[model samples]
Target: MRPPDFEARMRAGECFHDVRMLPAAWAVLRLDGHGFTRFTGRRYEKPFDAAFHDQMIAAAGRLLERFQGLYAYTESDEISILLPRGWDLFDRELEKAASLSASLAGSVFSIACGEPVQFDSRVWLGARDEDVVDYFRWRQADATRCALNGWSYWTLRKAGRNAAEATAALHGKPVGFKHDLLRAHGIYFNDLPLWQRRGTGLYWERFAKEGFDPIRGVAVSTIRRRLKVDRELPMKREYGLLVGRLMDGAGSGDSRRTA
Candidate 1:
């Protein structure tokens, strides 16, 4: 019962949409973010300990293996997945994996060190593997530095910088007087590990990308509060919010239904 004009349309080079749709089985999938210990005082010799990194790798691998045939990538702290179209409940699987990762992280070095960790997961529709790769690369190359600059600024200010008095000069509101303080300490954001610097920068850049102007340097107390907001809760909620939004969008008539 093919439409009478279907064959003719195909021969004439007609397409259903401007974008070429992939065959039915393929889908865009991903998980991003990582669990980490708060390094508030006395830098941990190495920004991220080797043992924690290994455990995260292992946890991600377990999830990847369990989801065989799904195109996968683990770049930086995020995990990307390209799933089969028929697998409708990928969120459930993601939740399971995230929960396991947190548990695994707890048993690892962060716990004994008195540092709590947090992570987040997200998936994109109509996204390509390269998109995911580029996103993470941006994180590594640029975003990390912002995070460091922000944190360093805050750290220095907390150590006693005239933060309140210097508010307008920094950006707008007072953050921490870290920039000036760090300068006194002879520590600069560029001196940190390249990856770590990216983490610092990217975290602070979130507001900018969303069209909001950044406050001076990052607010140490504010950034700490944000970190706590993200970390204090069990990690799965970030993923859950993404999943919920996707489901809501899909059900809404406003969204295109090509996939």
Candidate 2:
């Protein structure tokens, strides 16, 4: 075969497995930090760390901007970004979407934290509005469960319990037991920061920018967009409503009106 013909034959095999997302479906790209337990154990406080939380928020914001996401949630070294139905990034190719997003998140977070990190990505396609809401609600529920377990484990370890002992103390324990375990140590799970229990949310907001209009010779107020970091987020059904509102407003390019 000629050189041009040979190249064309190889390209066909390279593109054979590529897949694209449905044009009418919503996409949630979830990126999770790889080997983060050891990564954070070396650099951050046990149970919860504010600096790490802030870094995650920064990374999530970068992703939201790059992907034009409608909403983003971060908790425990993972981020889930909600992209609207018509999102056409990378021509909606699943392989490109997953790999590029993961690479970007790892790079942004590593720069912010001053350490190298890696992230793995996956896409969740939702066929309806309720599917998206339920997806986030499920993630928030997991966040609450994780916070309870972490606080319980670290509290035990701080009080002289070894690794195995701490795990034993919390293994198969009920939620009430975990809550009481912390209470006995003067740590109330409910009083911990909301972000620890419910995770943080990032979305867009619009503000008025004042500038002089050269042609009119008068100051003009123009609406501009910025990312808003939300450390306080609602839980359960209320959170579902928040997601629904964001989804509805995203189509109209009016995420600003969602308070």
Candidate 3:
């Protein structure tokens, strides 16, 4: 969460243990092509990465203030979000966000990519508002998996591998993608998550054995690991926004966990 007024929330002394159940949450994924690397390589080669970067940042700021949720922008290709419970019109809001992202990105890289764009496709994962913080922590892992899958295949293709060859390499990996689709002007999955830093995912647990419900001990460990993520996830900004909203009632000693 961003700089929160924990002291003020705690001063009220409301108990979080027995608070009423929170509403369901909706996930919104924002996808975009990366930067200006491809354009520079071929044509003018103007060191315009900085200019494009600023465009993205400004567009992000404009978009965030206009929407609601656990919002965050990835420097690379996507923004992952969460809508709090009670936001009855959440799905509609999500579509609006998608359109807005596409419009903004298109304008920013119009000359280079030759098109304004956001994600080619998107996915959604639902969660409860109360578990929102942990949800993102889990999602970053999943998103890392998603972005890595796409990037790895793209790398293979760029290195002279074909569709068949790239697909084979990404099998059993985190997030899978086709190499040809990602070879646009500037974005690659690897560039965003820096997969090299995280290494190939280990699949710490597979859902099949227990399905939606996990074994108690393992669940605790997973939650603990997610809650303690020192690294930033795509939803941190929105997480802060929601937490700040909830602080209205939660005491300083409320259930909110400080990072």
TM of each candidate vs. truth: 0.37, 0.94, 0.39
Q: Which sequence of candidate numbers ranks them by lDDT, best first?
A: 2, 3, 1
Poorest stretch of ten by lDDT in candidate 2 = 250-259
Instruction: For model 2, state the Cα shift of residue 76 in Å.
Output: 0.4
Error of 2 at 208 (Å): 1.8
lDDT by residue for model 3 (1-259), tens: 3336776577457453233223444444455554534634454312223444444444444443344433434443444433334444434444454555566545645644465444332535455454545554454555555445645665667778888987887676543234334544355544543322221111011121222324433322111211111123224466445444432322111122222
Candidate number with greatest lDDT: 2
* lDDT over C-alpha atoms for residue 143 of model 2: 96
Tell me the lDDT of model 3 at 11.
Answer: 49
Better of 1 and 2 by TM-score: 2
- Return model 1's CA RMSD, one decimal: 21.7
| lDDT to native, each model | 0.40, 0.90, 0.43
Clashes of each: 18, 0, 11
Worst 10 residues of 3 by lDDT: 199-208
What TM-score quantifies how close candidate 2 is to the native fold? 0.94
RMSD of each: 21.7, 3.0, 18.0
lDDT of 2 by residue, 115-207 (tens): 889999999999989999999999999999999999999999999999999998788999999999899999989999999999999988777
